[model samples]
Target: MGVLSTFLVSWLGKDAMAGVGLADSFNMVIMAFFAAIDLGTTVVVAFSLGKRDRRRARVATRQSLVIMTLFAVLLATLIHHFGEQIIDFVAGDATTEVKALALTYLELTVLSYPAAAITLIGSGALRGAGNTKIPLLINGSLNILNIIISGILIYGLFSWSGLGWV
Candidate 1:
């Protein structure tokens, strides 16, 4: 989804594409951390359930979601507060326009971290419970939706002249 978003942004111009690409680099790192945490949750839940311990499995899932969500919120807040500095540091030697655009993208995207963590963690829990189909469907649908929405946002529902497709 991040890569697809960058591709869509690329249509806007070179600077926009560069900015989104830079921001996405940082986003990927953050998401990799969440993926690691999700892997742990999946292992714990799978192990607990394998032992036929429903209670422990349930507790583990609940605690994992709560802790991860809280952590994501705190991380997002700090990133949002310091986004400019962070982008500046990461975007060294980039043009001012590119850096500014990257900062704005990062700031906006930080707000979604908590939701992203919840989705990743919840899907992982489901996978641990032996329901892999749901996670597959969820992720697939989200990617499709992201593409559609990004297109509409970038190009609008119709051409600006209102007489042809964008």
Candidate 2:
């Protein structure tokens, strides 16, 4: 999604793309929580299943789900609150215009962190359940949705003004 957005926003011009790409990099860092949850959940669940200990697997999965969800929500709130500073901090020596545009983009996108986390956690949980198909299907749907929404907001379908400045 970040790569696609880097290209899509390129139509906005170079500074726009640079800012967004930088912010995307930060977003990826935040998303590392998903991988942590997935890895921890997978290890515990897989270990339990290997030992044929259904109760342990179930307990670990439940505990991990709660902790990951809380962490995701907290992270999303932090991003929404301080996302501009984060953008600026990560943008290095980028021009002010680029930083402003990136802040605007972040404003439109910061709330999505929690939703993405839910999807990520769902994928992890499903993996723990030993069904890879569901996670793949869910992630596919997420990618398609990201494209559709970003297209609408970035390109302004139906003559509505796009989120980005033209």
Please give the distance, in angstroms, between residue 125's alpha carbon in candidate 2 and its true position after superposition.
2.3
Against the true structure, whose lDDT is highest?
Answer: 1
What ranges in model 1 sit over 4 Å off?
A: 158-166
lDDT tens readout by residue for model 1, 10-33: 777888889889998999999999
Predicted structure 1: lDDT: 0.85
- Cα displacement (angstroms), candidate 2, residue 159, comes to 3.1
Candidate 2 segments exceeding 4 Å error: none
Question: For candidate 1, what is the total of clashing residue pairs?
Answer: 0
Give candidate 1's error at residue 8 in angstroms: 0.2
lDDT of 2: 0.79
Which residue pairs in candidate 2 collide?
Answer: none
